[model samples]
Target: MQACRSAGLARGLGAVTLPWLWGSCRRSLSLVCAGSAPRAGDWRPSAGLGSRARRLSLSAATIVNSAPRPLQPYLRLMRLDKPIGTWLLYLPCTWSISLAAEPGCFPDWYMLSLFGTGAVLMRGAGCTINDMWDRDYDKKVARTANRPIAAGDISTLQSFVFLGGQLTLALGVLLCLNYYSIALGASSLLLVITYPLMKRITYWPQLVLGLTFNWGALLGWSAIKGSCDPSVCLPLYFSGIMWTLIYDTIYAHQDKRDDALIGLKSTALRFSENTKQWLSGFSLAMLGALGLVGVTCEQTLPYYTALAAVGAHLTRQIHTLDIHRPEDCWDKFASNRTLGLILFLGIVLGNLWKEKKTEETKKTIGSRLEN
Candidate 1:
């Protein structure tokens, strides 16, 4: 009878506590989704990942959390939990490499592999650098305050040490490329090293990020041709910058309201009420630059078809944009991954079509010679 009474008491307590616990969880989720900072002791979640979660139903953090406690902070620091930035950085490289394919051939698979691996290391390094520069600022931002460095899960010295390690690994990747490409890749570091400071000095920091993020457009072509000529990749590079301006602007809005409170700079805060118009202007510029890429590379109809798709996607993103809603901005920003994939596919298919025409011409010449 005593044992039964103890079980009954535990059941009664659980019934009383469960609803309150659920309520807290709901409140917490709301605050997180709304970009509101949680109290110091509360669990902090990642922002801009609701769409990612709904799609993958899992995240790097969830998987890394299952690992040993010692590794969780580092993995988050590298943004292994958020792979979108890596994808964004890498796709431009693929687009450049693929666009520069030998007439009727795929881009160098070996070079693509090198660039892909390099992108992972370099993007992580970039994030580490950004975190290091922004740790103090991060502490003041709702979405970023719990970042590994800002939360005191990792130290500044450790982050710099870690940054050094990433740069060393990236150097090894750079050594695999030809001298011109190596030099080009190395020069990009100037932009990377300086990008973090742009937010403090200019509302157009997204422009600086564009310059940094899109270096792969030049690097990709130079790796294949052993030279980066202005005539060949300038258009591609410009297109990438315009594209970055569009997506990064959307990304900036997520932080704009907070940035105003903190006096940080961004295109979102700069464009304010006229974002859709500015995005439209950027879109036209990107499309025009992409058309130049087709002309310079002599890409075929399939390439334009894919470009058309890219255009439609960008249009839809702009049309649906609700600048006041951070969640809406995040969804639009995340959609750029799909845009990158589409553009890559377009480049690949255009080359395949060129290859087919080349084969057809060769076959016809052989028949004539036989006759």
Candidate 2:
């Protein structure tokens, strides 16, 4: 009976291995593993496998895996495999830029692209800085145990050097803005450098993160308009901070157990059982501040609609969240990117609506005068 099972396994492999190999090599082999074996001379995989190969190749993990060995560790160090952080950092910039656009125009595409580039660099730098500081702590956390620095794949000295390169590149991007923006962007460095340490000393590290991560909300408007309008930029910035508090708290829950074991602190540990209540408060404050932004900017109905959508999304997130489950926490944290995009779209549409109203008002006044 054992011999018969072995023979069947070998036969199954003979039928399936060839097509799988061909697909991997040429991206054009069909997998027909369940069918009877084809005659050796006539066997050929179908082209359906190419689609699967294309999708696999497009994934960030695949790209990182395919990279040269020496570069792979650094790539992972930058968290390129996880782009949600980049989105979270960049979305506020998009919001501010869209809101700051001239009354009749779209946001500046060039500035958007430039800020996007800066977001990637600065976020990478922030990660590198964080890893360097927390490498010891990370080695004990299951989620972070395999991180490049914590796993000894990269030395602290090497990470520090890489961090310098990332910051230098980030500074180049900052220089592309006006003098005030450059000065404003430079001021954020202290926050970035210090944020990782907050986790060690206090439970409110996520608060410090909010301050660091949302600097772009202030910088984005100044980058385009040459300066910030406090009424618009301030409330927008506050709303972003509250938004960050919501998501990062959810994220911290993933490590709460490990953090407790290691004597590290986080909002997850700080809020413990009352996390839902705190999240609700933060959500309400975020919505209130966003509402203020709309009022001050004279945003249209579409903007208010988007805010309502955002409110519903957050309410669902908080209500459904299970803090004890790491996977659930991660999913909730990841979903904030969608929340960010919703608000950004709202701001863009709000600006367009305002522009349309202005055009109609001008036509009305001109026709009345001519009559």
Clashing pairs in 2: none
Write down the lDDT of every candidate, Cα atoms only: 0.79, 0.79
lDDT over C-alpha atoms for residue 269 of model 1 = 91
TM-score of each: 0.83, 0.85
Per-residue alpha-carbon lDDT of candidate 2 for residues 223-271, written as tens digits (9 for 90 to 100): 9889989999999889889988999999999999899999889999999
lDDT of 2: 0.79
**Candidate 2: worst 10 consecutive residues by lDDT?**
23-32
In each prediction, how many residue pairs overlap at the backbone (N, C-alpha, C within less than 3 A)? 0, 0
- In terms of TM-score, the best-performing candidate is 2
